[model samples]
Target: MKLPSPLYTTQYGKAYVGDSLELLDCLSDNSVNLVITSPPFALQRQKEYGNKSQEDYVDWLAVFAKKIKRVIKNDGSFVLDLGGAYEKGRPTRSLYNYKILIKFCEDLGFFLAEEFFWFNPSKLPSPIEWVNKRKIRAKDAVNTIWWFSKSEYPKADIKKVLTPYSERMKQLLKNSEKFYTPKKRPSGHDISKEFGNGNGNGGAIPPNLLQISNSESNSKYLRFCKIANIQGHPARFPRQLPEFFIKFLTDPGDVVLDIFAGSNTTGEAAEGHGRKWLAFEKEKDYLAASSFRFLENNKSDSEIQGFYGALLSEKEVEIRSKQSALIFK
Candidate 1:
């Protein structure tokens, strides 16, 4: 069967170096199975790559959300990873993400499937003014992951993203009689004996707070970047971020798209899970450096070269100068 061509297609994914909005316009309606991205945060101070200011952040993201709603299939999902930011010069936080969420639901006709919080335990303390000096607020470590669907009933299976039962939970299940007794609580909820059934086949449902460690001290990707003398994307998410959503939202061969693919973490996760994926990044250097993430998967030297050539190729790269949108801290 003949497949539609992308800018630079790989064995398991494609890379497009341009504005995500333009790329979205080129894609067919209802073609993508999932849209997962972590756009740069609207922080008080800009980082290495540029980000939208608080004044324009919501409207800018809303524009893409409107287009994404069209490209996603009826049962498709759009997973967004956004870090919390403080208002410019103020100790208070910014509600730009909430503003975008409201716009998505009210204007874009999207449903709020669920809100997931990603807690990075290894994250360092930041915003010295509040956390270290005045001591008014704690160090911010949790990022918001909004799972929006085209329709209210998007394709999802909790079983795909279930975590293994804890050792304590396992002991409790075996000794329910000794540990947990069925009883009505102060909340007037009935405690049933059926709580322990079918747990062997299924692990417990993960909570909204997903505590995935993002501590990668040294890895192949970093090693490759070092040898190649390339500056990697400063704000890269852990692969586990996308892995959870991709597994929960899509199946094998499903198409996933990452509009703001800093370091292409979403594409890497999708490819690892046997999903067809696409990535769009405006920063040429960052997109070129992100190719290092797949070095281990290349069986031969030729294969590695072929993949790198495709990403850095002049003919393959449709370069466009756009303000980079990325922030993970």
Candidate 2:
């Protein structure tokens, strides 16, 4: 079968605005170094992007996973961020989306490496059916990130990604340095040691449980959605979240793929971090917003002016310049 074409190379990187499955099929096998994405949640509310039945949702998402498996390098990793769903007006934590995805990946021959929780302490509270109907309280939060690999051994540098120790931790390490010092080595043997005080090293290497706020007011994402005249996708992740993974998992110039690129947070984060990025969004409105945001965030003033000169009439440019100045002020 024929595949899609890669498009639009920028200083930040290249991004394809189209269907994810078709785009993945286009990529060369083992071409991608990392895959990070947050797909649409199977929620009851009306999603700005396409929404389907829960069964269809899982099946549709599986097709993208299959393609991801094809393109990811043998030692590469995949990170999927999913949220749990409720069923029959009850708080069913058992119906986790990650479970189905994990099973699907395992069946498709991907190794299940690790699972992390993006714990949002700022999550909205979900009302309980029993209490609301005159009984108890229901749970609120709903997001999980799953990490998978193409092989048993993946390319991750844990030491390079360690979070630095805090001031108190540094002091403790200083106090305990003598204890960590090695005793006399055997004759002619080269002995070296790596040690720390172990008193809370900058939040313990960023635990699988991540606690981040999800407030969206005045965010660049909201601004881009407004400018593009698109209804914002409800499940957009914070840029910092994906940025951490990009920094920790991949090196500069490595290819990063987000098959279910939702609002393209992974692409934005990858660009900011000097990594090559590929994102796929099926919805046209989302594609437009993602493209505009990616370009706008990465453009310099001179570049923006050049674009204005080429695309806008003199009167329109003057109006736009005034608006831009007003925004900066």
Candidate 3:
């Protein structure tokens, strides 16, 4: 499908600047292999990038859910990462995130493929009234990641996202006979002798609890934003988050999308993984700063300024790869 003129282009993707709903409407049905995004949370306090209040968040997000369902492939997946919120002025937690899951599955005809929690080890203590000052609650460090699929069996491969085996598991693999024998436990599941022989699997299957730190203090994107005197997107997810889903859910040539492409991190991940991607963000400054992700690191300060200057001045700037970076026509 022909999309609008992109704010910037990379070898693997294009980043668009506009309302996501309007941009998504331009796509054809079953065109996307995966849609992974982290929308603005329904925070108690409003942020500069903009966010809906808790009461209106579910209905607001449902509108996009319908559009996403129409565009995604039959076996495709929609992965949503939502940060938890507390009730206004109270210490009570809000149920907006869970509500979105139930609404999408029960009302929007999506299946709950699985649920995952992203544990941000570097997350700060939040809602100072309750957590930091009053000391009534623990730090809110985990974001609920809902994996929704149009079909019961979505395209996924656990092997693609396996973690390295622990040291003990390596020892067991090397000396299976010395360690123990396979047997049934109180759990009532029978352990086969095949467990003794190394299955030749590269790593162990990872758990649903994903441990990633949100540390991007000195990335190229941030450096560019600093040079341009632009404020960076505040809630940028680590690139690993998108890389995980892209590997597990889609092949190299499949299309991946991020509806709320703050700083276009998903696009960068998709590019690195050889997937065609589309990023939609409403803020032009954020999209402009994201172009730095695709540029070669050796670019000088003057050259970088010239590139960014064109992005700001021109109606649309085609950001060709370093091999063809100067080709505007």
Best by lDDT: 3
Roughly what TM-score does model 2 have, to 2 decimal places? 0.76
Report the lDDT of model 3 for residue 171.
76
Off-target runs (Cα >4 Å) in candidate 3 are 187-196, 322-324
The TM-score-based order of candidates, best leading, equals: 3, 1, 2
| TM-score, one value per model | 0.87, 0.76, 0.95
Model 2 C-alpha RMSD vs. true structure (Å) is 7.1
Write one digit per residue (lDDT tens) for candidate 2, span 1-329.
44443333345555455677667777899999999988777776656665655656777777778888889999898888887776656555446476565666667888877778887777766544643554465555647777888998988865545667776556556665544454546774432222333443334366777777788677655654555444676667888788877887889999998877766788878887889887776654454345444444544555544433332221211112212331110
Name the best candidate (by TM-score): 3
Write down the lDDT that model 1 would get. Answer: 0.80
User: What lDDT would candidate 2 get against the real structure?
Assistant: 0.66
Local distance difference test values of all predictions, in order: 0.80, 0.66, 0.89
Off by over 4 Å in 2: 1-8, 94-98, 127-135, 177-204, 224-231, 295-329
lDDT winner between candidates 1 and 2: 1
The C-alpha RMSD in Å for every predicted model, in order, reads 6.7, 7.1, 1.6
- Show how many residue pairs clash in every candidate, following the order shown: 3, 3, 0
Q: After superposition, how far is residue 285 of candidate 1 from its true place, in Å?
A: 1.5
